[model samples]
Target: MPISDVSSLLPLLVAIPLTGAIFSVLINSKHGQVLTGLLAALSLALVICAILLGLPSEGLQSTTAFRYPLAGWEAPLGIALSLDGFSALLLTLTTFLVTVLTFYSAYYFSASPARVRFWPLWWLLVAGINALFLSADVFNVYVTLEIIGLAAVALVALSGNKAGLTAALRYLLVGLLGSLCYLMAVALLYHLYGTLDFAQLAAKAESNPLSWAALALITVGLVLKTALVPLHFWLPHAHGSAPAPVSAILSALVVKASFYLLVRFWMEILAPAVTNDALMLLGILGGLAILWGGIQALRATRLKLMVAYSTVAQIGYLFLLFPLLMSAEGTSASQLAAQHQSALAAVCYFIVAHACAKAAMFIAAGNIIHSLGHDDIAKLQGMAKYMPLSLFTFAIAGGSLIGLPPSAGFIAKWLLLNVAIDTGQWWWVVIILTGGLLAALAIFRVLDLAFIKPEQASEQVAPDNWQKVPVAMPLSGLALALCTMALGFNADLIIDLITIGGGE
Candidate 1:
């Protein structure tokens, strides 16, 4: 299949969500949720269509057939949209998460008027993500980034509490700053290459002061948005204070958007200009992020904040791929390609695992926090007696984060470790193992409070809303966790898909 075969349908991915979001605003409270669900389903269906029709067996080796020019104008003058293995995987992940989040939100916000407001913003955010993944132009990505940032900030403020408001303000500022840097880079790239298209720029990019400046600007902007360490100061507050579903989206998908862009830039557009020393610098930052973030998570007093900080740690693991990938270039020509593909597959798998695991953990945390009326771990005594489902959900999610057996995280970690050893990048091995152990400790610290036998089995009375916790709520978390665990067995499917698009 070529992109032209499905070019007519590509716009629908962006249109469906944008329309749904606007329609949500006009609909009454009673129908808002329904509109959101329908739109999410339709958007997800569109992603499936993209995977099937836009991705030809030829892969990215010759992309002329798959770059769909928008509004009858070709690149350098008009927008273009392209899909490959990488974009397909991310689009699928985004829609799947949105679908689950939509359904879970219906039950989560059933009692509040907030559901009405949540629907529109949620749909807009989905629109942004879908657009970002499909976009073939860097300028388009910048536009999508603003859409995502604004929508996310609005969602965070939906709680309407002072803390949520404050967090949203900080998030807005940080996002704007990142956008400015990125916009500057885009301008410079356009000026230097006379094009905004990824493929075109890749061919034209040079190892010069201009390219380096652009790379530096783009990297800083993306890392800030990605919440990479030193720049991750705002994440805990924003994630912890936002509503649970919002938190899940922010942690699992929002940050990944920036990271995805970074990957595209580093691996494709800017690859010729990047040096090994620069790549090594990124890997070292990742190692530090793992250690520092894990320690912060362990020290956090609230469960939600702990989960937020854990995101910081897991994000670090994603960066470890850089060194392994860089080192692969040194192998013999016969083996070099295989090593590259393996490293790519490993990192992609890790990202998928983290998304599923982190989303499950946050959803489960939301439930526990709601049930206990607070998120303080020490106050979770005897949660096992009444909230066993949530406890189990949390445990499964946490286990995945810790790279436990039969989980996606375990498989990803295994692949990464093997690659590190094979590539002779043994330093990352220590960081990987240490990060996993620290994750285990952090999760256990929270679980330990849950399992503590209080003076009485029923010492903590169920909150008003917990008298009969809906099967849907806890099941939502369980569903995501199950997906993560199932990935351990189904990795081959993902690898094949990514390999096609990656053309490795």
Candidate 2:
């Protein structure tokens, strides 16, 4: 297969899903279910095509990236789509999660009127994520992030309950504030560099007052969007109250989108303007996020909230890479180069691992919620008796979160530890280990609830047949967990793929 043919699929990635979303909304009243299902399948097919085309053939060491400017116009004037190794992997992850959540959504909302609204918004979010990952310009990135935020807020509000609506409103406000900050940065960058194109800006970027202001603005905005601590006030309410499948994708993929853009901008366009003091500050915040999020999770009384807070903690691990990556500077020429690659590779693996594990955990939590008709941990005693598969899935996903052996999280953390150790940043090592222990405590709290046998029959609420654990539900969670664990065994594949276009 020609690389060009594969590269051509880049535009279709954004187009197909957006088209599916629109078509589903139009045909929903008459044949919404069938039409939406078919469209989702079609979108998934396009996603697979893009990924397969993006991958290099055997014996090939590098894959060519495809860039297509809209309307045959070049950047700084026209919009463009571009995909390389990093974006391709994220696109693949986004599509896979959407496909799985689509299946899970069908089962989850089978009887709810909300299904009509869910499919379209879900695909819209997918489209936004795809577009953001492939976007080559900062302005286009802002546009895509808006789409993602709006779609996600709509999904959260789908529950139509007071809690869900309130949470959605909070999320929308936070998202808008984040976007505003990011837009300010984009404006500043464009004004300074005369172009918003990432490559163009990267080449023209410098350490100057205007650039530093943009950096601060972008950092604050992205950190808020990514839900890094102190700014993460809205995540638990939003993720906890949304539907299971909604929560799954929100925690697993939505939050990661902002962080992804942050990484891209920092590494590609703003590295020259970034300072060591700033990087150190980010690492400190990450360490604090790990501790704070973990403590909150351990204290959370609801399963979904616990999982949501776990996302906060898990995200901290990704931020730890910034300091480690910064440490590469001022080193020997060869060692500096190697350190940069390792840091990128480590962060990428950590992202992939967390995506799978967190998605699995949320799906499983959804199952447990469905079976018991509640999400309270205290009321979940003896749930393992009825929802064994979900409990098992939770255990596996939690094991990954705890960085246990033979899990993707383990491999990611190992890579991060080596990077920190090699750079003599051993303080982060203690933070990492402590975060793991806290994660373990948080996870086992739910497991402890699962192990308890209800003393009275009245204590357990018997689920209706329709509310019983669907075979597809647990399978969805299990499949993600298995994939995460499988990554541990095939770490080299992840390392190679993440490093594809991440070169000097």
TM-score of each: 0.95, 0.95
User: Model 2 scores what on Cα lDDT?
Assistant: 0.85
State the lDDT of candidate 1 residue by residue for 1-504, as single tens digits.
545566666677788888888888888666556756666666667656565655655456643345577888988899888877777788778878888888888888888778888888988998999899889899999999999999999999998999999999999999999999999999999999999998899999889999999999999999999999989998999999999999999999999999999888887888888887888888898999999999999999999999999999999988887777674444686586677788878888988999998889889888876666678777777777778888888999899899999999999999999999988889899999999999999999877877766444355544443555688999999999999989989988678777665543
The residue-level lDDT of candidate 1 at 258 comes to 93
**What lDDT does each candidate get?**
0.85, 0.85
TM-score of 2: 0.95
* lDDT (10s digit) by residue, model 2, range 299-391: 999999999999999889989978987755468867876987888888889999999999999999889777667788887777777788888
C-alpha lDDT of candidate 1 relative to the true structure? 0.85
Worst 10 residues of 1 by lDDT: 456-465
Per-residue lDDT of 461 in model 2: 47
